[model samples]
Target: MSIAGQIAASCQRAIGITLARMMSRRQFGQTLFEHQALRLRMADLQARVDLLRYALHGIAEQGRLELRTAAAVKVTAARLGEEVISECMHIFGGAGYLVDETTLGKWWRDMKLARVGGGTDEVLWELVAAGMTPDHDGYAAVVGASKA
Candidate 1:
């Protein structure tokens, strides 16, 4: 596979593992809020998110985050994969085009399938730009949501 594919695949694996860890039922009570000593953790997490939202304040951050999110991950994976595979294909360009596994053709094929799996990079960039500004009344919404 090409460098793009290799990078994307590695990132996918790492992200998958992290999400898996978060979703595991056994890890439920391990949540930071579950402990009295770390009762402040919830606030800390919120602060962190708020900071992240701010840090990613412009189009650049938004675009990058959008690309990495669940919505666009597959697409990114495929694109990067294709880039890498294409280069690899170039190394053995003529022969690689016809084969499957060893030729690293699967990388580009998978990426092609994934590119349209969900939102396109352009759409995500727009979405994120739209999402940049925080809701001024968000704290109230959080309070109301918590009560329910």
Candidate 2:
């Protein structure tokens, strides 16, 4: 799997862990998942994860990964993974800080490494943006569209 795919998978695992933790960990007389704010956050994370997975599937179906596509995916996956994992850590509160009690801390640290691994976000963004011209249509090119 590409680094982007690995990061996306990691984010999915973090989401699953967070969901399981929320369902079992109670606060204010109810499980953490019972809170409206936490529910909303979970929804947002789910949506983003779905989008990333969809993109990966599309790339797989194409049987080819363009440079722009890989760069965009890497940049997006790194940023989103970091944000999602960090949010999961926040949801875990102090327990997230303890490696023995929860794996959020480890996931958070691993995600940081992803951001720097394939290439920095700035470099990847430049590669993506360089192809995003009126004629080039970077998104279409990545998705293998014949025309923009």
Candidate 3:
């Protein structure tokens, strides 16, 4: 993976770590208000966040975290971004969208980085599913398909 992919994958890992921390919360209000946006997304968002977090970690372990890896990370990260920041933006009803301190506006601007950087979304799907047989068909042959 490229340097940007490496950083993106690392950020994914960091987000997972933070999510694990958030799961310990006893109440939704505490999770949302007590924690920062990053932490709130983890605690309140639970199911989807956990699924993508685990998936991103799995993809990172494959090594060479590329744009694909970034895409995979974005699957979870984007959901969280949509929920936490976008919700805040909605709550503000236009005001938050304009304010950088709330970070909804910043996230709205910065979202492109996560969406396309490292790897595009298509690349991530291929990476996650181990897409395509080579012309030589190495994996198929290993499992007892006719030898190439």
Q: Which candidate tops lDDT?
A: 2
Instruction: Give TM per candidate.
Output: 0.37, 0.87, 0.41
Superposed Cα deviation of residue 89, candidate 2 (Å): 0.4
Backbone atom clashes (below 3 Å) for every candidate: 7, 0, 3
Write the residue-wise lDDT of candidate 2 on 1-148 in tens digits: 3787888888888889889989999999999999999989989998998999999999999999888888999899899999998898899788897889888888888889999898999999999998775756775687786554
For model 1 the TM-score comes to 0.37
RMSD of each: 17.0, 6.4, 8.9
Q: Which pairs clash inside model 2?
A: none
Give the candidate number with the greatest TM-score.
2
User: Can you write out model 1's per-residue Cα lDDT over 99-146, one digit (the tens) per residue?
Assistant: 543434554575565555555657755655665666769988998999
- Using alpha carbons, what is the TM-score of model 2? 0.87
Ranking 2 against 3 by TM-score, winner: 2
Query: Which runs of model 1 end up more than 4 angstroms from their true locations?
Result: 1-7, 10-75, 100-103, 133-148
What lDDT is obtained when candidate 1 is compared to the true structure? 0.45
Off by over 4 Å in 2: 135-148
- Candidate 3's TM-score: 0.41
